[model samples]
Target: MSAIIDFTTAGQNFQAYRAEPTGVVRGAVLVIHEIWGLTGHIKDVADRFAAAGYLAVAPDLMGLAGLDATLLAELGADRNDPVKGAAAQPRIREATAPLRSPESAARIRDGVKEVFNHLEATAEGAGRTAVVGYCFGGTYSFALAVDEPRLAGAVPFYGHANFTAKELAGINCPILAFYGEDDTALTDGLPALIVSMQAAGVDFKYTVFSGAGHAFFNDGNTQTYRAEPARIAWTETLEFLEKHVQ
Candidate 1:
């Protein structure tokens, strides 16, 4: 079962959706949402992870203080409409702006720390733990792994890399990073980043899917959905988690 819970972190109350496995959990995973925040898609991802025999929890890292329902509604509504989707950019930016700031990132780190604390208190949290995210969430996943050493693994699907080689050195766990070959910004720096990670002795697996663009894993986005690559990515992700967490 999954429920919404509120916890205090960095002087603010953050909301999170936690999904527990049917019986004893093999491990715990912190699911992070995209730039749009903790929408239905993110919740669905959490539910999927729960079904996979893990205690999956997705925290509303956007502070959960002033979420505009109208904006959120538009975000979910425009998934299939490119014309309407363009209009949603500004709102999404506005929603995620707080997280872009260094101060806000620190707060989010604190929030994630609280989440880990709660998970550690659970029966299923004994073995291993991981963090996974999509798009913006992917970026946070990397940040969380760097900030929190307890994480057993980190997976970021098409997320922007915010940490440098120096910062990534702090990540003790393995990372499975997926990106799109067509993602301009990521494509440019990905090679060097991979090299740097290898040089720094960071255990990592990186894959770039051809003919797919950003947000390719999101089945909700008709324009960006590439069924084959998405499926492959999902399969690889599950396999990686099973090896590390279970």
Candidate 2:
């Protein structure tokens, strides 16, 4: 079953696309969307997790970043078309620029916490929830692991590890992160991040796919999608979640 559900946190009401497992639920997953917001691609990913026997929820976390539902919807629609998506990049960047602000990051972090709290309280109970995210969502996946010790696991794809050793020390779960070797913006910092994670005693493992670029897991974009890498990453992500969350 699937539906749009409403949940509130810190006096803020948020809407999420939720998909329930068809059979017995083994675990639960929070699917964080790319910068495109809660587009159809995100919903489809949630459905895929549901078909895999995990309850999945993709929260629309754009409100705190200055993106309204109407604008996000239009942007999502534009992103579905190659030509339109290419042309809309500037607009998309402008609209989401506020997310880079420290204030917005703090607010979004709370939103993510609330979403996870809702999942634990109403869906999978406790100790059986993991997070999987792409791009922007991937960045938050790492942050959430640090902020929410109750998180079972985190799978971040191509997002920079922005936390320092002190912040990373707060993480209690294992992480399975993926990246494309060509994404220098992230891979260039991998060595330092590894050192920090090791010093923090965090169980962090990562894969950098050769020949793949940033957003390689986003098959919706022909320019960046890498089939073989994405396929392998998906398989590994499921395995990681099974071991940690299930």
Candidate 3:
């Protein structure tokens, strides 16, 4: 089952695409979108999680930045088209500019928490909700793992976050991160992050795929998709969620 539902958080109303499992649900998943917002690709990912016996919710966080579903969808289309995508860069940047402030990050986190609160209300979702995110969403995955002690686990794909050891120590759940060796902007910082995570005694595991770059799992963007790595990451992600979220 799938639907678009309205939710309120931080005094703002937002919509989320929800997918429910037909069989017994083993866990719940919060699917976070890339910078493109809650596009069809994200909806498809949520549906995939639902088919795998997990209730999945993908929130439109971009709405807080003044980007609606219609505009996000159009921007997403432009992002996937090489010719138009290049021309649409400025507009995309302008649209996302408002979300760069610390206040915006806090509001976004509140929205995520509200979604998690709803999931927690479910019988099978109480202590079994995991967060899976890509790109921009990945960064929030880390943030949530640190801020929300109720989270079961976190999966971040090619997302980077700078955290002091003190902040990292607040994470109570395990983290499973995926990265591409060629995604230097993020991968280059992995060693330092690893050190901080270890110093903080957090359970952090990661995988780096050779020949893959940023957004490797986003098959919607043909330019950066890596079939083999994405396949492996999907399998590993499912296994990790099954182990941690149950």
Candidate 4:
């Protein structure tokens, strides 16, 4: 079974959609959503992880303290409507207005830290935690590895590489990153990232699937969805998590 739960961080309450493994647990995976906040597809991803024998939690990373609730709904309604999507982008920006501060960034990181804490408190496989995300969330998963030593592995789909050599040295876990050959915003940065990770002696492996574009894993958006790559990515992600999440 799956449900929404409240978690407090830095005196602010954030929501997460959590799902438990139908069988016993193999481990826990923190699933981060794209810039769209905690959408249905993100929840479905969490469910998929649960179905795969992991305790999955997808947090509402963009659900800031002062967001206008009505705007959130409108932005979500634009998910499939081209015209509405263009019109709703500003609302999406508005929804993230409060999170643009340094203090808010700390709060967001603290919120993620709490997920690891929750797993520890419950005696779940906190020590073997992995992080997976798409798009904006994927970017964060990369950032987390730069400073977080608790991560066992990270699977970031088309996320930008955002670490320096010094920052990469802080990573003690392996990373399995996925990218589309056509995602310039992400792949363009890979050469420098590869150098930094290699210099830091981090175990980093990545694959760029041909003929795929950004957000290829998101089946909800037909325009960018590529089933073949998504399938391969998923299989490799599971294998990587299994190999590392001991």
Top lDDT: which candidate number?
Answer: 3
Candidate 2 wrong stretches, greater than 4 Å: 72-87
List, residue by residue over 117-182, the lDDT tens digit for candidate 3: 899899768999999999999999998898899999999998877877788999999999999999
User: Lowest-lDDT window of 10 residues in candidate 3?
Assistant: 64-73
Which run of 10 residues does model 4 get worst, by summed lDDT?
A: 64-73
Which of candidates 1 and 2 reaches a greater TM-score?
2
C-alpha lDDT of all candidate models, in order: 0.81, 0.88, 0.90, 0.81
Q: Which stretches of candidate 3 lie over 4 Å from their true place?
A: none
lDDT of 1: 0.81
> lDDT order of candidates, best first?
3, 2, 4, 1
Spell out the clash pairs found in candidate 2: none
Worst 10 residues of 1 by lDDT: 63-72
How well does candidate 1 match the true structure, expressed as C-alpha RMSD?
2.1
lDDT for each residue of candidate 4 in 1-246, tens digit (9 for 90 to 100): 998999887677788999998767888899988766787888999999899888888888665445554466557668558777677777677776786677666666677778766765665566878899898778778877775788888888888776667888898889999999998877888888888889999999999999998989998888789999999999999999889885
lDDT of 1 by residue, 26-114 (tens): 79998988766778888988998899888999998765434554566577567457677787777667765665567766676677778
| Residue 78's lDDT in candidate 3 | 86
